[model samples]
Target chain A: MYPKSIKDLIEDFSKLPGVGEKTAERFVLFLATQKEKDGILSFSSHLKEMTDKIVKCERCHMLTEDTICDICKSKERDTETLMVVSDSKDVFVFEKMKTYHGQYHVLDGVIDFSKGISPEDLNIDSLLKKVASYKEVIIATNGTVEGELTAKYLKALLSDFNLSITRLAYGLPVGSDLKYADELTLNKAVENRQKY
Target chain B: MYPKSIKDLIEDFSKLPGVGEKTAERFVLFLATQKEKDGILSFSSHLKEMTDKIVKCERCHMLTEDTICDICKSKERDTETLMVVSDSKDVFVFEKMKTYHGQYHVLDGVIDFSKGISPEDLNIDSLLKKVASYKEVIIATNGTVEGELTAKYLKALLSDFNLSITRLAYGLPVGSDLKYADELTLNKAVENRQKY
Candidate 1:
């Protein structure tokens, strides 16, 4: 058997999805080899800070350090449009790109028929309440079946609203080779082409 | 950009060798969803504890919580023979299977020409010192060119001493289907067959 601390930490890390026992061992051993232990010790405090400080924003259901997320509180962002996403990771991805200038509404997860999930089970109520303030709601959920199903359901739910509703563009990615593009993506690229 | 704490923690976790940015995001999100946040928070402290607690055994060069590892300190294990391993991971593997009963000398790594590693870079000096007290030395390094080179070098180093030296058996692994076994392994299996 390994040292108690090594075994315990390996179990904790291995429980994370996608991390195997071998990877867990490597991580533990790596931490042990780090000469300046403070770097690793600080990681613990950060987890605690995230646990205690991060909260669900009441306005948009995004994780934040305050009652309302920074995006919802920002004046420079386009309050005229909102992006509807499935999780905070999606929000993080968009923020990393710094391309989108709109706020987001996290649905948490898409509806799953097998799992018996419905629109009411998600953050749909808050999204419905927040969509009233935006001129447009861009459905930015991923292109999976559940994501498509959730987008359709949201469209039906918000049909009577005065604002426009749009789904994310489906076509060839920005830098992908056209020859290697899948049939569905290639077809969508042709269908959605604009005037040159 | 995300919150400072979120971004910092993601960077730390992603810096681990095998963890990608996507996997790091999933790990962080999974920790955030834990019903009891202590599970993840404790992991950080455990890492610090490992850094402060674990040390190399002075006698055998194995990782231990004390100056002498349990194996080296044990009286029941064969004192006349010792197993030479590349790393603590190999020790853990033998322990997990309850197969090996001899003490271990951790070489840490082997000579690699491409990596510019030499015998001096490993724990060879300590191994040479320890091998003098044993009657036999078993080279248990992996079946790589570097491993064989190290074993040969160790054998030459211990030839002047009274101790006999041996290498681990190389043949087809037990329970492997002969049809799927590689040509080299099949050849070794036939070359090293024992009386049935």
Candidate 2:
């Protein structure tokens, strides 16, 4: 058995989302080890800094240190187009491609009834208020049932705002086998085929 | 892009084993979220405590706050029987069974040539000094090639001393299928068959 402080550290680490007890122990051991002194110091300092400084963007609900996130404040991005997603991470995923020049709105929660994530818990109000500035609102939520439900709800909510509501088309992935495609996705792909 | 402090936190989280960039982002975001305030405080405090307080046991090289570990100082354990291991985690794995009342010696590392962990880097001198007091030494290092090399080297190191050196038997795990057993393990199991 370890000392009280180490035991508490391991317990706290295990409480993190993905780390289990064994992994938590390993992390603690690494922290206490002689080689990891510098790493531990830097990590702790960064964690403190992040918790103290990071705040949510007022318009899009994305995590940021400033009142508004970079994308929302940037003049380079297309303010007339907006992409709505479930989590802040999705904003990063879309940004990684360097293709989507539009702004983003992080819903932060989806309509997962089982998990108690209702439409009311999300930042949908800010989205509705912000949607008026954009000509097009793209529902780039996950391809799950909750995402579909959230998109439908958003579409209905923003219907009277005179903005074009578009959902990402369901199709086989870029390099997938047609034989392995799910029936629903295959059907949707066929239904939404273009002239080309 | 995220703010400076949050970005630094994500980088630190990503440095942890089994945690990727996306998972690190999720962890940092979770930390910044309103719901995780209490956990963040406790986690930081515990981390600080662990880094500041925890020290290695002088006798067996196990991590602890005291000069000697609880197991080493305990009068109830069999001081004559020493269990030698490559890491302190192995001590815990054996302890979890509630058996093995013998004393332990943590080598802390093995002959990891790839990582440049040689015998000199280990606590071998302390083990030799302490092993003389014990009649039997059980090498309970990991079942890896490095562990075997360490065991062989230890045997040679301790051959001049009057003690019975033994290695843990290689066999199918207690609840494992014989059909799924690997070739080396099966061979060892067959070679070291025990009488009922």
Candidate 3:
């Protein structure tokens, strides 16, 4: 029982992953209240500016204003090592870790058999062409079944290529002691143990 | 450790209520991903437009584009009864209920002794002037101590006026059974029981 416009906004916001009715209501109310705190005109203008100006990088598919991504265009990055992820959000996470100076390729989604997604649905062809120039391709997809299947599919597709393909080494988590590692993690850790 | 611009945007989004670091990150990423979604730019632009264009109703302090609130400017509303609320949010709630037919007066805040807010700090002077025109005043503040105190202050300030003053009667909620009501509510229910 809110105004039609308010209700519509709430419904649209509620479609987000975690927002519920209460949160949706709070968000719309918050937006409505901002009209009083800051001039509503500026807020609306900002939204339009962001939507109109923000564009995706043509090369890496990450959000950027340039024709190519900063990572892909940067001479400082190791272009020979391409880190592939299912979504751009994963790129943000790794960027937060301040690790890896290699360029990135976002698939935008995993290859899902159940959903009828195939290799043709992914940006894998571009990746294959790029692999000719790169020495290594690192698959950083999630450890879920679909992610694993996608990784396997990519491996099979790139089998004829000369570049070295690698998956992130499975092991005990950084903070977790070896003794506290779960059975599955322990088994994977043992199987993938390094010489160091 | 994302890019400086990304970090700044995330920080700004995080200032909103109920949005944490992960959520802020997700929101930014979602905005970034909108490049792939159709009409997302238009939606964002619409939000910005609303924010930029909306203005406060000078009379009732509700968010609107007009000089006075639609309710206040309406001829059908009863000018003899005024409902006072602490904020415009509460005004929205009352409007949603569609139960009250009177105009509203926003205090913006309560008379908090600790906060050094007295009756003079609020729109009480204007409210007193409104009292002359109205036959009854209803204080529809929250069920908190500050709300009670504000209501009491209004009541005392208008004690000399010939008009009737009342607070909204709240007891057990509409859906709540008497058996499920708390002891405090049950006590209040018994104490304030009415003869039919």
Residue B158 in candidate 3, Cα distance off native in Å: 1.8
Q: Residue A107 CA error for candidate 3 (Å)?
A: 1.3
Q: Which runs in model 1 stand beyond 4 Å of their true positions?
A: A172-196, B33-36, B112-117, B173-196
B32-70: candidate 3 lDDT, tens digit per residue: 566454354455554555555556677766666568767
Please tell me the TM-score of chain A for candidate 1: 0.95
Model 1 over residues A1-196: C-alpha lDDT tens digits? 7888788889888988878898898888877656677777777677777777777889888878889899999999999999999988788888988889988999988999899887778999888876788899999988999999999999998887988999999988888888999998889999999899
Please report, as a residue range, the 10-residue window in candidate 2 chain B with the lowest summed lDDT.
B33-42
Ranking by DockQ: 2, 1, 3
Model 1 CA lDDT for position A25: 89
Top of the candidates by DockQ: 2
lDDT per residue as tens, model 3, A16-41: 66779878778777886652545434
Docking class of 2: medium
Candidate 3: RMSD over Cα atoms? 3.6
lDDT of each: 0.84, 0.84, 0.76
- DockQ class, candidate 1: medium
Where model 2 places Cα greater than 4 Å from the true spot, the runs are A115-117, B113-115
A best-first ranking of the candidates according to their TM-score comes to 2, 1, 3
